[model samples]
Target: MKLVPLGDRVVLKQVEAEETTASGIVLPGQAQEKPQQAEVIAVGPGGIVNGKEVKMEVEVGNTVIYSKYAGTEVKMDGTDYIIVKQEDILAVIK
Candidate 1:
């Protein structure tokens, strides 16, 4: 499915948390919390800020960290993705 953000919003696919512990031991799904890291699947063209248009600092394929409780869950072609604003994006990972 194609995603076109309306404004300064972004659509992200949730990245799964570690399936194993730091010691290389595998952990069950019940042991993990919802992963807050996400991949930038799509982004808006820009948004209106002040009297000018402010473009998004993010792009597709960027891995970023965002607020855990932010964004809305959406399903596209049976895949889950989150929709959030740029303001909620904390940082971009290397």
Candidate 2:
């Protein structure tokens, strides 16, 4: 399924946390944290501001770093997804 975010919102397909360390230390399933990193798959058009449209800072295809528990959880075609406002987004990771 494909989705487009409404004004100033974005949809991120989460990148999962690695379960093992480089040194070969394995992490328990429950012990692993959800990765706050994500690939920006879809973006909303610029949001309205002061009666004028404000362009969004993040764009589709940008990788971003967000709060660990920032977005609303959603599921699409068996894949987990997150929806967040552009204002809630912290930074676009390099």
Candidate 3:
């Protein structure tokens, strides 16, 4: 099975949190923070949404930064994914 977003929705895969800090201190799983970075897996086609023209600026495989608490989490086929709105995406990494 695959995930396909609709309207202005975007699907992303969260980047893994770092196990160790810059100071070289290893952190436990419970101490790790939620990652704000993600990679685009699937994108919805641009279309009218809420009476506004929604154009998709991001594409598949695009690495992006998003709001901390932006998307809904889901597990599909043992793979994790996040479903968010295009607006929730802050910027695409070059």
Candidate 4:
């Protein structure tokens, strides 16, 4: 099933974390940190939110960095996804 975000929500698929350190040390799965980078999968249409006009600044296929603890985790057909608000997205990778 495809995820369709509503309001100002955005759907993202997280990028894979590096398995090796800069020093070339291979880190185990448990030792790897969750990546803050993700690719935008879907974006909700911008509209009035909390009585304030909101406009979407990201789009599908855009890579973005988000807050470390933001968004809700979801699993669909074995694929993991994050659903976060536009405000939670800190920056869009150029």
- Give candidate 3's whole-model lDDT: 0.82
TM-score of each: 0.75, 0.71, 0.79, 0.80
Counting clashing residue pairs in each candidate, in order, gives: 0, 0, 0, 0
Tens-digit lDDT track of model 4 for 13-50: 98776656574323233333333778999999979988
List RMSD in Å for every model shown. 5.1, 5.1, 4.7, 4.9
Candidate 2 local accuracy as lDDT? 0.73
User: Which regions of candidate 1 deviate over 4 angstroms?
Assistant: 21-35, 49-52
**How would you encode candidate 2's per-residue C-alpha lDDT over 15-87 as one tens digit per residue?**
6656565643232333334336778889888668556686888888887876545579889899888898776
TM-score of 1: 0.75
Candidate 2, which segments miss by more than 4 Å at Cα? 19-35, 49-52, 68-70
Q: Candidate 3 on 50-76: residue-level lDDT in tens?
A: 899999999999988776465799999
Ranking by lDDT: 4, 3, 1, 2
| Per-candidate local distance difference test | 0.78, 0.73, 0.82, 0.83
lDDT of 4 at 76: 95
Lowest summed-lDDT stretch of 10 residues in model 2? 24-33
Better-scoring candidate (TM-score), 2 or 3:
3
* Candidate 4 regions with alpha-carbon error over 4 angstroms: 19-35
